[model samples]
Target chain A: MIEVRNLCKHYGARKAVDDISFTVNDGEIVGFLGPNGAGKTTTIRILTCYHPATSGSARVAGFDVLSQSIQVRRHVGYLPETVPLYPEMRVREFLRFRGKLRGLARGERETCIARVTERCWLGEVVDRPISQLSKGYRQRVGLADALLHNPRVLILDEPTVGLDPTQIRETRSLIRELTRDHTVILSSHILPEVEATCGRIVIINRGRVVASGTPQELRSRRGDGAVHAEVRAPVEEALQAVRELANGAKVTADAADGWTRLRVEATGDLREPIYRLSTQRGWTLRELRRDAGSLEDFFVRIVAEAQMQAPQ
Target chain B: MRATVAIMQRELLSMFCTPIGYVVIAGFLLILGVLVILTEGFEPGQPATLRNAFGLMPFILAFVVPAIAMRALSEEYRSGTIEGMMTAPISDAQLVLGKFLGSAAFYAVMLGTSLVYPILMQVYGSPDWGAVLSTYIGLLLIGLFFLSVSIFTSSFSSNQIIAWITASVVLASFAVGGFLLVRHVGGFWRQLIQRANVMGRFEESALGLFTTGSVVCFGALAGLFLFLTIKVVESRRWR
Candidate 1:
């Protein structure tokens, strides 16, 4: 439902968003992963029509961001990094106002308000002043505002920031629920949050798209293909035997009092061979757990590699 | 139009909900009353006239209107609410005009309370009704100018204090340059400054002379500032 092509945004000499391009299909949740100042928010702003792209084109729900911004705005619901709420306004009133501003008819507005109030779990705080709400509720209020118009696409920038762990989980589930009918583009620095919530991930660094794919796809790109195993064997003998067994494989070994810890890199799963080796060597296998690198590991390795290669 | 009215109503509601609105109106009234009593030389049985009441309006407006409008967009910017607003379906013009009208409406409320001064005049003496009406017209016109200037100042930064000071400084120029003391400079420079004076634009309306030139002058000045405000707001999105 969204298409961005070679978008560039510059502030004088510094480019905040480089020539980036991406697309979001209907009912898919996409995560924008980047550290601070990585142009995540800048990209979101361009898609929302809050700011103009320096060059190239962005279309939301089939409307051009520059030529048809109003129509684009109508089709997309946006939750900025900070929830823009008037402190004095109560929740219900604020949502109602937002609905009307989106040009919802009277009855339609009321129905949408009620629907979002329930969907975002805002019913309890419906009458509370925004200033009195907890961070979690404030985040929900932001979500509710975006959903009130019932737009086909939702763009949320850091939807889970500053919330407690439980609140973050709740927000994640809420976002996941939204995927049934709406396309979601969420930007966040927390890798696990994105991994748990998004079907696809787009990693950005220094105003450019570094990588974009499914979590599993990005993880495979790390090329480590390494599996970590904790084998409780005679410290010296097990390390020597495992090193010999995995011929030509790079194995890093760490020996403690009783057990040897080893990381073995192979083209594919070596769990069966490693187990057979341990048995043949007559070593006590106390803890032999296979490790699959997660999205966090994948993200850190990529970003750190990029940073090292970057010019000062 | 519906969007404009929605924003205007929200702004008006926000103003009335807080003590800032009350403080502004009460402060203006207290200062106006005290100034009339001290400068106009009150008499026990004589009717009150807006002559002294409106005489000090230009000076009061220099600060009052900016104070009222200082937080309109500046606070939204500071608090990051502007991001929310910009993401909304409302156009840039709607946002700018809404804030301008919201502040202007507050200024109008401040001016409306001063009507008590004229009513007090009727109770004491037969003040010229025509001059009183013209003076109010003058006050309203001045209000429009200050509103636009303050809204434009609000666009400069997210800092409300900075916005207030900047707007005050810009608005104060009209008061200072228009003052007779400044205009009375014994040189050609005085004549030039006097011709450019904003307070001079208020002269016809205050004196009960319904001059088209003065009316046009205030209207154009207000329009100019409002246009500037819209431009600044639009430019900020790019930056």
Candidate 2:
């Protein structure tokens, strides 16, 4: 539902987003992963038509962000990082105001307000002013406002920032539920939050997209395929045997209490071959394990690599 | 148009919900009342003309109107609610018009309460009804001009106090500067200042001379400031 091509945004000499391109398909929840100052908010702002991109183009729901910004805004519901809200307005009143601004009919506006208030768990404080609500409730109200018009796409920037653990879980599940009918692009620096909710992740760093794929695909593609083993044998002998068995393998060994801990980096799983070697050598195997790389590791490695490649 | 009305409705509702609206209305009426009853010396048998009341309007609005209008957009910016308004489907012109209408409605209310003077004049003495009507029409025009200037200043800053001060200075240049500086200059300069003077046009209307030139002049000034406000709002996307 959203496509960006070679987007570059420059604020004077500082580039906030540079030559970044990514797409979010319909009915998919894509997590936008990036650290602080990773151009996440800048990209979101451009897509939502709050600001114009300096170069390149973006389209949301088949409408160009620059030319048809009003249409893009109509189709995309945005919840900014700071959750812009009128403090003096009651929850229901604020949602109704947003509903009217989105051009909802009178009957539809009432029903939508009621539905969003229920879905966002804001029924209890529907009549209270927003300033009187807690941060979690305010965030929920922001979510409710975004969903008021039932737009096709939702772009949320750091949706779970201020919520407590329970609120965060509820928000995650709520977002997961939204993916059934709406396309969602959620941006956050928290790794596990994205991992738990998003089917695909796009990691951005220093104004560029470094990696984009499913969490499992990213983990397997950039993962360190290694076997770690601790054998009750001479450190040098075991290291030499493992090295001879797997050619071109990088082996690192450490000796502690008469046991050699070997980390072998090679293609494919080497646990079976290492097991046979321990049996053939008559050496007791204390620990043998294959490493499954995690999304965190992939994120860190990609961001570090991007930073290294960035012009200094 | 519906979007503009919706925004105006919300702005008006929010304004009245706070204590500022009541304070502004009461404060304006109190000051106008004191000026008419005490300083201007009104007796029971005095003539029912509201010359003193309408005479001070341009000067009074120079300060009071900004106080009413300073919070229009500045508060929205400070509280971060401008994001919500801007991200809505409404265009910048619609937002500016909506806010202007809301602030105009508020100034109308503030101006409405002062009509008691005219009604009282009609009861106690024979006042020129034409002059009374024209004076009110003039007040509304000047109020629109002052409110537009205040809204323009409010758009430039997020600080309400700074918005108020900036608008006050700008309006003072038109209201007070014309009279104070006209005496020091002669020939074309005096006429130029007099032409730009808000009080000069207002005095023409208060004297029951309803000229199209004065009407168009006030309309043009308000339109100019509102246009500037729209430009400032649109410039935010780039800057």
Model 1 lDDT at residue A15: 84
Which candidate leads in TM-score? 2
User: TM-score of predicted model 2?
Assistant: 0.92
- For model 1, the DockQ equals 0.68
Cα lDDT of model 2 by residue, B161-199, tens digit? 999999988897888888899899999998877777779
Q: Least accurate stretch of 10 residues (summed lDDT) in model 1 chain A?
A: A284-293
lDDT of 2 by residue, A1-312 (tens): 899999999999999999999888899999999999999999999999989999999999999999998999899889999999988899888888898889998999999999999999988999999989999999999999998898899999999999999999999999999999799999999999999999999999999988889988888897477889999999889989999987878999999999999998875789999999999999999899988767788888888888888878
Scanning candidate 2 chain A in windows of ten residues, the lowest lDDT window is A217-226
Report every candidate's CA lDDT: 0.85, 0.90
